[model samples]
Structure formats: structure tokens, C-alpha cells
Target: MASSGQFAIVTGASTGIGLELARCCADEGFDLLIAADEPEIERAAASLRADGAKVEAVQADLSTSEGVEKLYAAAKGRPVDALLANAGRGLGHAFLDQDLADIRRLINTNVMGTVELIHKVGNQMRSRNAGRILITGSIAGFTPGSFQAVYNASKSFLNSFSFALREELKDTKITVTCLMPGATETDFFRRADMMDTKVGTEKKDDAGDVARQGFQAMMDGESDVVTGMKNKLQTTIANVMPAETLAKQHRKMAEPGTAKD
Candidate 1:
């Protein structure tokens, strides 16, 4: 049986890499506080409980300040030993055609939501002078995205934020690691309405593999890591290649009208 003392909070834990990450944490014997926006959260939590890990499930729309606040309320006063601020959404379509409300929600959840939770929980961790944080980033942040413009931009913010955050917390023992994954097989593609695109259709890394790589990296205290060799090469090319070239390549894969219909 898993001990109930140490705890890790993971947002977006209903499915995909988040679900896998929660499971991985459970395997390592950490009790969990997992949140997701959907009703399936209860089901997911129930399964975790069955596995003998003490679990708390919170269903809140992470795209709003209220939602973030609620999750914080559930976690406040508990000495969170680790945090996985992984809740996020994806947007598809041309920038102009995108709905303003959806764009705002993406910004709220992907950037603001994560930031607020980190601030709340991170402060606690900092005060204790002990904790670990694993923020989920993506290869999408490495370059300009065509159809996934806003989604990519949000990730860019997260990537940059994580880097700066690591530096800010450098003197503290509270390690922050950013996990940048590329095209993983998850509900993210369908949820983002990108199932027809290259990233949504191509063979991709399994969520379990990506989660384990991220978990190990977080425990090892690596500041940032891309999950696969191919992805690492892509990040390398993205760094050295001209923006115009990279953007063009990205458009071929991400632009809804540019790729095959």
C-alpha cells in the first residue's frame, strides 16, 4: 500500500500524459491531488484510489481564475512535496479565424492558470525550502506554429517562464524541471481539433514513455529536457535554423489549409 503522507498535486490528470504522470507518481508511492475539467476526473481518481494511492479529485475549468483558485483552496495548508502544473489546452485554425473567447481561455489556462497555481504552491515550497516542480512544455514552443499559432505561443510562454523561474529559484532546493514533449499519442490532438494535421496523424511517442522520461528527469533535477532523440534533434535544428525556414516547415505540418485536405 502507498503511504499517505507525501503528496504531489497534478492538474489535467483526467487523461493523456497527465494521467500517466499521476500513475507514475503513484507507483513511486506519492499520494496525489489530481484535477481535470471533465466528469471523467472522478473516474480517474477512483481508479487511482483503487490502486491504493490516497487521491483527491478536483473538477475545475482551469481556464479561469476561479478555477485556479479552487484548486489552490483544495491544496492550501497542505505541505505539497511536489507539484505538476500540467493543465493546458490547444487551439487550432488560422489566427484571424480563431474565436476571441477561446483564445482568451487558452491564455488563461495555459499561461495564467499555471502561473497562479505555481505562485501559490511554489511559495509554500519555497518557504519550506524543499520541493520539486515539473512543468509540462512542448516541442511546439520551439518554433512558429501555423494552425496551432496560439497553442504554440502559449507553450513558448511556458518554456521561457520555466527557464526564468529556474534561475529565480536557483539558490533554493526547490528544483523546477520543464518537460518538453513532441507529438505524443494523447487526447490533446482531438481536443485541439487537429486530428487531420501531421502532428495529429503521425506515429508519436507513447504517453507512458514520455511521462517516465519526464518523471526521471524531474527526480534527477534536470532544468529542461526534450523527451526523445528525434525531438532533441528537432530542438537543435530549431535553434540554429532561420526563423523563416522553421516557420515554413512548421506551416506544412500545422497549417490547416496548407497541409493535405
Candidate 2:
């Protein structure tokens, strides 16, 4: 992709797809403002800087207004050319087996925090009427995640919300693109406590590849882009498959200990 000397903000950049997405932005010649809840975000920033990219990393808990404000403040009134709202949380196992606190945190980070940041930055994009927004949704949103209910639901919300937002901005230059990736090689499965499950243990797509696909789609202003061919076929089947059947299939992959079962 050709380089653009612009500004962008990518959240959840400490590791995984978020970090790769930030790299794509830098490669495209965009000055970056990246954030994550972990201190590793600073390290990610340093590495990007080593490559001659101008990056500002913020360690903020984006599940609250304060964190959202901190990120928005970092831009200091400069217009953002792109907003990669990629911060999200995941949880595995039965809903009943999970603590409500963890569940709440997951929901807040995935849904609330993401929406808050978008509402703030999206308005600025609107005023300028030229910006690209890439949201990291999941192919898990296509089905009912039996053991991973909340996380899937949050992604479904994002998938739906992206379409609505895109339509709302259809008359403008602002484009909202949802990047729906299936399982990818990332710390997400471990962080979600699903290492014992089949999907967690199975081979998955590369995070860098996924990020490149997403970034390209966003630059082209596509409505949505699912990362892999297998995932694309799966989602196609999901459209025709009954919800209960999809849920059952999801259970087989996401249920704890299913890898050995």
C-alpha cells in the first residue's frame, strides 16, 4: 500500500492483532497514537519507533470514561485519519462458572469502552468528513458461542453496530469497516482461559496476515472483511445453519477440556 502521511489511533496495541494493525498503520506512513491496558504498549511503541515510525503509546484501562478521555486527549486536537478500535476481551467456559466481575469487565472493555472511544473520535472524523475506522469484530459473532457466550455476544454487537454505523455514514466520506477474524495465533485464547479447548489448541491464522487483510479492506472502504478462507466458508455456512446447530458446533471447539475429550 502507498504511504499516507496521516494520523491514526490504534487501541489494544500491547500485543496480538492490535500490535500488527499498528504496524500496518506505520508502514502506511501514519503517525500513531496507540493504547493498551498493559505496560507492554510502551515496548511496542519503542519497537515501532526503532523502525522510524512516530508512535505514542498510552497505558490506559479503556473500560471507563477516564481512559477514553486520556486516549482522545493524546491527539491534542489533531484530526485522526484513521481509528482502529481493536481493544476487546474474551472469556471461556460456561457463563455460570465464570465470576460476574470478570464477565462485567469483559463486557465493558469489549462493548462499552469501544463504543465510548468511537463516539468521541467518530465525531471528530465526522466533522472533518474524511477518515477510516476499522473495528475488530470476530467470526464468532456469526454463531451462538455456547461456552463463550458473553464474548461472542459482544462481537455480535460490534458486527451489527458496524453495519448500522456504516449506513448512517453512507452519505459521508467516513467509512466504518468491521474486520471479522476467526481464530488467530495470539495470546487471546490463553488470556481468555481457553487453552484447554480445541480452538485454542488448533492451528490458526497469523496475526500479521489478519491485520494486513483488515487494513487493506479498511483502506478500500469495504463494509467487512473476514480474515481467512476457511472462516469465510464457515460464516457462509453459518448464515444457512440453524442457530442451535451452530451453537453445538461452537461448543465442541470452545468447551473447556474439549481438546482432550
Best by lDDT: 2
lDDT computed for candidate 2: 0.95
lDDT of 1 by residue, 1-261 (tens): 758478899999999999999998998899899999999999999998889888999999888889988988887678988899889999887889989998999999999999998998999998899999999999889998877889998999999999999999999999999999999988998888877777777788999999999888898999988999999999999999998798889878876643344
The residue-by-residue lDDT of candidate 2 on 161-183, one tens digit each, is 99999999999999999999999
Per-candidate clash tally: 0, 0
Lowest summed-lDDT stretch of 10 residues in model 1? 252-261
Output the TM-score of candidate 1: 0.96
Instruction: Name the 10 consecutive residues with the lowest summed lDDT in model 2.
Output: 1-10
